[model samples]
Target: MLLQVRELKVGYASGADVLRGVDLSVGASSVTGLIGANGAGKSTLLKTICGFLRRRGGAIAFDAADIGKLQPSQLAAHGIAYLMEGHSVFPGLTVEENLILGTWAFRKERARAKQAVERAFELSSVLRAKRKVKAGLLSGGQQRILEMERLTLNDPRLVILDEPSLGLSPKLVHEVFERIAQMKADGAGVLVVDQSARHVCAASDHLYVLRLGEICIEGPAASFSDRIDELVRNFI
Candidate 1:
């Protein structure tokens, strides 16, 4: 597995547990969809794997290395990238500057960084058009695309996207899912959590239905699609 998460648990200092004993694995050439109701620990699991939330128990192993103990920056160095739920771009920076920031974690390699910027532009022509404009001025959908582009900048082996389609129109949501399909086709391991079950399943190789911080059902995405309406209702 490219990423292995076993019996993970997470909770705040004084709050109830948010993630309870979640286990998940993603292979190098697959896209996994994490679906569930609001506050069901989908985002929490992503955060735990990316080292944003401290795990209360269990382990996160990536490429045979224990990563649960690493800091966020260190985790990124280990080739894991996280795209959060909302627009994460720097509002004050130009689109080009925001894209450049994605390469900050890379070792000083001018050529590679430049190539990454160009690749990001190619992936989303909207960013290319507004490269010199402040990222804050872009539409919500465009900002989300920028965030995904930033996460892919380092060519991370595993990418975790939290609600990549949140609050977008159907047209924009379709575009986001298309990009995700392209990413999987490029052999990137992806773990995506989204409220839109049908769209996510369509793009995923496997599906995991999370309920109240625990996995309820998991299987091939194609199989789940046969009963997607029922499954989505169960999550809600």
Candidate 2:
């Protein structure tokens, strides 16, 4: 597995548990989907796995290394990339500049950075056309696309996304999910959390349903197709 999270627990400084004994796994070529309602601790799980939040208990292993106390930058260096909600990007910078920043780990290697940037451009011709434009000026969908492209610089082994479809039109949401699926095809493990359960089910290889800070159900994506409606109604 590229990422393995076993009985993980986390909470805020306020001392209330946000995640309680969550278990999840992602393989190098798998697309895993996590679906839940607003307060189900989905975002907390993502943050904790990426090392943005401290874990109160349990373990997180990425590429076979325990990462319970690693910092966010360290996790990224260890081949994990997180594309947070809001499709965050450096709005004031040009597309190329933002991509260069994504190559932070290899900044001293100018030739390698250049090649990585070229690969990013190849992901979307739209990005190539707007390579000189400020990121803030692109349409919302374009900005989201740019955010995904940035992950290419690191060529990460595992990719985590939170609500990638948020604030996007239906077509844009489909496109974004398609890009995530492509990551799996390219041999990168993907762990995605989204509110759109139907969309997530369609894109995932495995599905996990969380309710009240716990996993209520988990199985291969196809196994839940028949129960998706009822599952969403009861758990999501």
Summarize candidate 1's per-residue lDDT along 1-236 as a digit string, tens digits.
99999998889775778888888999886899999999888988988888788999889999878888888878567778888767789999999999898998874998999999998898677898999999999999888888878888888888889999999999989988887877777778999999998998999998999888889899999998789999987675
TM-score per prediction, in order, is 0.95, 0.95
- What are the candidates' C-alpha RMSDs? 1.4, 1.3
Colliding residue pairs in candidate 2:
none
Off by over 4 Å in 1: none
Compared with the true structure, what per-residue lDDT tens digits does model 2 show for residues 97-142? 9999999988888899889999889868999999999999999989
Which ten-residue region of model 1 has the weakest summed lDDT? 179-188
In model 2, the worst 10-residue window by lDDT is: 72-81
